[model samples]
Target: MSYFRSVALGAAMSLAGVAGAAAQEVQERTMTLGHVVAEQFPYHTSAMFMKEKMAEETDGKWTLEVHPSGAMGGERDALDALLLGTMDFTWVHTAAMASFVPSFELFNMPFVFHSPEHIEEALSTLDFSKFYEEADAAGFKLIGIGSPAFRYPMNNIRPIETAADFEDIKMRTMGVSAHIDTYEALGSQVASTSFAELYGALQTGTVDGNENALSALNAMRFNEVQEYLTLLPTVANIAVLVMSKSTYDAMSAEEQALVDEIGKQTVEKNNSDYASMDAEALEAMKQEGLKVNEIDDLSSFVEATAPVREKYSQDLEPWVRDLMAEIQELPSAK
Candidate 1:
């Protein structure tokens, strides 16, 4: 009986050691997050916030390494890396991500949101279950999304107080079909330009103008090149944080919960920060000598974009269209 008791104690000790080793291995795993935006962008702040919170909540069990300013590569490359499991995560504008996830084009609908608040309210209500299901099927996971403020036209040539101003203006775009068509429909000659060359393009007359969130515009220092900003039919932006589905699934249940909680906190912080950054950017741009004009007749721009939206809608999936309808009906914050 004494020998048997001694043997049982030895087995229990070995099992406890094995469990401790497994827990240590789980805690030592590192996650890599990549993004194309500069550190000046609020996205970077949010990413770091998420990283810190994750490390704290997990008791330093997981550490996140962030790569900003396209250090890893472009957004598209990051998405590919996520699928290949070379990158654990990436954050990118849904507009740029539309090529990989066509349903994301739903956010591109002009005049769908009035302010960041409206977009957030809709996001809080609209079911993204399908998006996750689809992303998982494609080997990517949609972890969280943030409202990226509103997009408006900024030009060097003239104030776009009216849709007529867009006539004959050459605008740089991401070369997405919907974006190109939207500008063309509104009467701008669209130029598909690289992000790295956008400032040079505006300065050298390669394109007269472009549209983006005010924060992003300032982050790129477009205020240095672009002289005029026309706040028109505001377009909303969604920044999606993506990860490899397999990578997320492989995390221990506790680790996954921590990640999810941190993701939600990141989304909230980024969106609210982006919303406030818009006003700060406007003030900064004013100080930078950019003439800003508010379009009194925003309805005109919306009317002009009607055909573009209709054309794009024709190709969108049914659920995407339904999602668009829901988003358009969300309470406005104008």
Candidate 2:
């Protein structure tokens, strides 16, 4: 009777241990993260790496379902969907975000970022807490920045080395007013062209030129259609990752910490990858026989477009002006 009693007691202790372990297990969640680039693009590749890390670090409690190539929708559409609780997260160009958050335009300001390193430093030291707070009020949260999207002018007309070359060139630009204002100030004929329609427009002479990050030019195979590329990366393609604020708020503290860590890790990795990818894209475009020219004196271009800065400053809200001042005070990219 004593031996049987000992056996039963041991069995009960083992079962209790198992039950406690199971009870302490982290909850499983499926995160849906989306980007506009195809799988081959570094944007998608970095996202995949981050997702893998998130799942592994959390012991498979968090698995990500990535949507690439705009399968979810355009960047703006994804932003809207996030508010409706249909999309959980997105990484999109800052230009696409400017419509929803006007202050975002500062990132895409012409000649703002001198290099990847410059922008990377700005990312760390810049005070975007206000923007984050504003995002929360509007149902979204700005988590972190992504990509080294360096924008340059690609055209069917001629190689552009100086602002003078822009005279009357029909340039395709995003619907962002700053771009239109900048190009118009430089004497280029600006027209809004959706990314999907740009290739056809350039091929058929509807627009003589367009400016985009070198990665985009290579990814979209624009070199095959365009004859010349201005090596001036006028606008850095600033991108950011965002999530639904309400959803984020609802997560457990531990889960929220994991999300924040993952976002930072992903941003750092993407910036490193973007440097190499941008170089490769430029080389590929050159091999494809696109004439590439460098602006010997960018001051000429800057001087010609000064009014654009004034125009924006005179009209923007007071807080935006203060934000721009902070950026201007940062050290230029080395």
Candidate 3:
């Protein structure tokens, strides 16, 4: 009778342990991440990497369902969805974020960073954290910066060889104020349009020119529609990945930490991947029979936009000047 009682007690203890483990395993969370870029795009790839890492870190307790290629909607739409709690996260362009957070327009300022390394360093500074905090206050959690490829010009008109070349051309620009102001200063008519309509807009003569990173041009096959390519590095288009505060706040402390760490890792991977892809895309553009032109007088282009920058300073937050000054002081990129 004593031996039988001891056996029954051992069985009960084993069953209790199994029940506890099952309870822990049932604690799972799901999040939806949206991106405007295609699945093959670097930004989307980085998001996927983050999703995988998040799952691994939490031992499958956390999972992200990615909606790529504008499946959820455009940047603005995705942001609205996030606010409504329909979308948990998204990778939005700085220009897109400008509508929600006016202070973010500072990033669209031309020639903000001299090089990719400088851009990365400036962004990694402590001041950048303040922007994230501000985002949190505004109902979203700014995860980290995703580096889009370098900006260049593609035109159906002539190659942009000089400042005079920009005179009176109709250029399609992202629907952002700074871009409109900058192009207006350059003597071009800026038309705001969505990415989905850009190719048709270019082909149908709705616009004579457009500017974007080489990777984007290649991804969209704009070389087939545009006749000229100019290696004019105008801006470093940065993307910010954000999560809805409602979604983030609902997670446990351990899960939140995992998400934050994954965001940092994804940002670094995106930066590295973009640098390489930008070079490859530029080469591909050259081989596609597009006339590539290198401007001899870049200073003229910069000087022509002085008034625009001054106006941006007046209109934007004081933090813009502070961030710009910090970027200028950083060591040159190798």
Candidate 4:
């Protein structure tokens, strides 16, 4: 009986050792997050914030290595790397995500979100949670949406005061179908171009105008080449942070929870920081002698695109409409 008791004690000791080894193994794993934005960009700041949050939550068991300023690769290349598990995470523009999950194209729909608060509320709602679940099934997991502030029109041709000013103007776009459709609906010829190529396109007259957030215009020095800033509030472009499903699944349940929590915190921080940055950029642009035109009649722009929205409604899945409705119901911060 004493021998039997000794054997039982040995078995328990072995089980405890095995558990300790497994815990140690978990602590050894590292995650690398990549992005195309410069270190000065708000997206990078948010990425850093996420890293700190995740590190604290995991108690140093997991560490995040951030690659900023397009050090890893371009948006498409980074996404491909994530799928292959060579890269663990990244913040990609929604237009870039459309290549993997076509439903993301709906995010490019102009005027879908009226304000930053609306967009944030929609993202935190149940509908977007379901959308993230679907995205996880597609081999990528949504972390959170990066704040893109308000988009405005900048052009070299002429000041855009009305929708009619868009007539015959060739505008550069992110090469997404929805954006192309929106610009075309406004009577402008849309030319799809990469952000890296935009300066040359503008200088060589390949495209006469481009739409982007105020921060991007200032960061990219578009103000140097562009003459007019049309505050049309056309869209709220989003940068979506995502992780490879395989990489995420490799994490223990506790580690997964930490990452999820960090993502939520990062979103709020990004939104608040981006809003302040945008205001500063706007002031700087005004000081630089850029003609800043605020369109009092945005109704003309919205009215002219009514048919465009109708034509594209069929292309949008029912989930998008559900998400939009939820967003509309949220309390406005504007």
Candidate 5:
């Protein structure tokens, strides 16, 4: 009996030693998160929230160093940096990501998502295993999906309430094929310009207008350069918080769990923050001399852009097509 008791005590001590070593393996480290948005924007504010939460969850062992305002570069550049291991994480909208993952073009399909709430519902309930597999193939891990709002046409030249309003209007797009095709379908002359140079382009009349989520437009102060904001929900602006797969793989399982948890929380924080910001920004912009209008006849614009959707859907995989159909069928605020 004494020999059995002695053996059990030694086994327990060995297990404790192993557990201590495992805990010691989790070293204090800070990861970098980058995005091309103003500091006051939800992208930055939510990142800061993640930063604080990460440190608390890890007991100060893990933290984040966030860079905003294009300090790291545009969305594409940031994605490249992640692939090259220079950036650990980045927040990028689906439109910018479509070039890297062709299937992502589904998210950029014109008029697919009716409203921001519809997007949120679709993302939360969708089976995205295939999307994640593609992202892994591209050497990145999608940590979270955030739909702050829908993109709308904002211009300096005139109010756009119908497809006719887009005629001969020069519009700047992210150079995504779908976006370019959509604007062309609507009869707008599409101009390709880097997002960093968009403000200057709008100010100099190089481009008459552009479309973006209200949060981004407000944060960039597009109202200062543009005259009208038409509340036509053109597309759901789906922002993904992504991390380098290599970086995520390097972390201990426990640390990865912490990062994943915080990434998800950041999404909720962003959604809440954006709702407040959008309402306040709209009211403030109106008082500051920005003309805002709502589309009375959305069917005309939808009909004009239908070709853009059909053109892109021709090459989609079966699963992607099925998912797209389901998302479109989701209930919308509109």
Candidate 6:
């Protein structure tokens, strides 16, 4: 009887140990994701997707609460909060990220990425290790790269078919140096406007024009304030989904893996959805009475902006410079 009792007790202890270890593999917590875009935009849509999938995948062990439309402040403020471990996640425009991680300036250069298909290819094939390293050093862990569409000029002024059309046109741009310099180089006076304040500025005529993806233009109701959208494809509006390094560090290995998996899925969904959204939004805007024009001869605009590209790329790290060349060389399709 004593021998039987000893074996039973040993087995009970081992079973308890296994159960405790398994329990520790996933920690329960509610995380927050914040961005400065309308709920109808890709940024918010992706966040909500992430939130739902994370909850299902983790079996309620983790919850993601999303805040949209500057509830957590602008892009810079959200990034700062992430570094201080106050915010868990955010998806910011690559131009805005240049200030936080200088290497991101490589993405802000004009015509570096030819189209959405080209960007998708470059992101999958190019070496982003250097970018990831720089972001890590800046307290951000980049989990995914996504883009809606190339940016085009939108303004109440006449359609910008030629380089000369930009002359004397006041334009609003994010306060990034690369964007500001590029617009100024093209002969347009630039206003460094907060994105949240941009619609009001346009409505009040504080600026004559701005540039953004068609989906964004529609989502923000730019059609109500601006009359035309010129399809110039000046630069790719890349969006990066990042998590707080400290928050990542505090997660269990299993939990971290779960986050990574969900992050990739979220961006893949956003990118696929953007293709359709861009088309649908364009038609929606047209029906709303917004004039749209396409420029087949981007040669004039490209030539004018060539100097701006050269100026920005001149000082990039060798790896980034090499990556830029590789990306530009990739086929526009496939």
For 229-312, candidate 4 gives per-residue lDDT tens digits of 987757667878888889888877756765676676776666656776676677788899989987555677777776666666
User: Of the pair 3 and 6, which is ahead by TM-score?
Assistant: 6
Over 233-313, each residue of candidate 1 has an lDDT whose tens digit, in order, gives: 456667888888778888776667656766777777676566666766777788888888875456777778888788777
> What TM-score fits each model?
0.85, 0.85, 0.84, 0.82, 0.84, 0.85
Give the per-residue lDDT of model 6 (tens digit) for 1-334: 2222232234221111111223457778899999998788778887898888776666677789999988999898999999999999999999778889988988888777655667768888878888888999888988887864687789888888988888888998756677777788788999877887999999999989998877878888988999988877677788889999999989877777777878877887676556656777777888999988876676676778888888887887888888888887788631
Model 4 bad stretches (over 4 Å): 1-26, 124-126, 192-197, 200-206, 325-334
lDDT of 2 by residue, 219-253 (tens): 88888888998877577787888987766877776
Per-model CA lDDT versus the true structure: 0.75, 0.74, 0.74, 0.74, 0.79, 0.80
| Candidates 1 and 2 compared by lDDT, better number | 1
Candidate 5 ranges with C-alpha deviation above 4 Å? 1-25, 156-158, 193-206
lDDT of candidate 3 over 1-334, digit per residue (tens): 2222232234221111111123243358788998988777777887888788767665687788998988988999988888888988898888888778767876787766555556757766537766787787777888887784457778898878877888988888765677777777788888776777999999998988888877888888999999998776566688888888888888666556666777777777676656656766767877888788765456777777777777777777677677766776777432
lDDT of model 3 at residue 286?
A: 76
lDDT tens per residue, model 5, 1-334? 2222232233221111112223455678878999998888888888898888767666678779999988999999999988888889888988777768778888888888766567767877878778888988998888876754777789877788778889999998767778888889999999887888999999999989998866668768899999999877787677888898889888888677667777777877776666666666666777889999876567887899989888998898888889888887776534
Worst 10 residues of 1 by lDDT: 12-21
Could you tell me the lDDT of residue 126 within candidate 2? 78
lDDT of 3 at 108: 82
User: Clashes in model 3: which pairs?
Assistant: none
Runs of candidate 3 exceeding 4 Å displacement = 1-26, 192-197, 200-206, 295-297
Instruction: For each of the candidates, give the backbone clash count.
Output: 0, 0, 0, 0, 0, 0
Question: Which pairs of residues have clashing backbones in candidate 2?
Answer: none
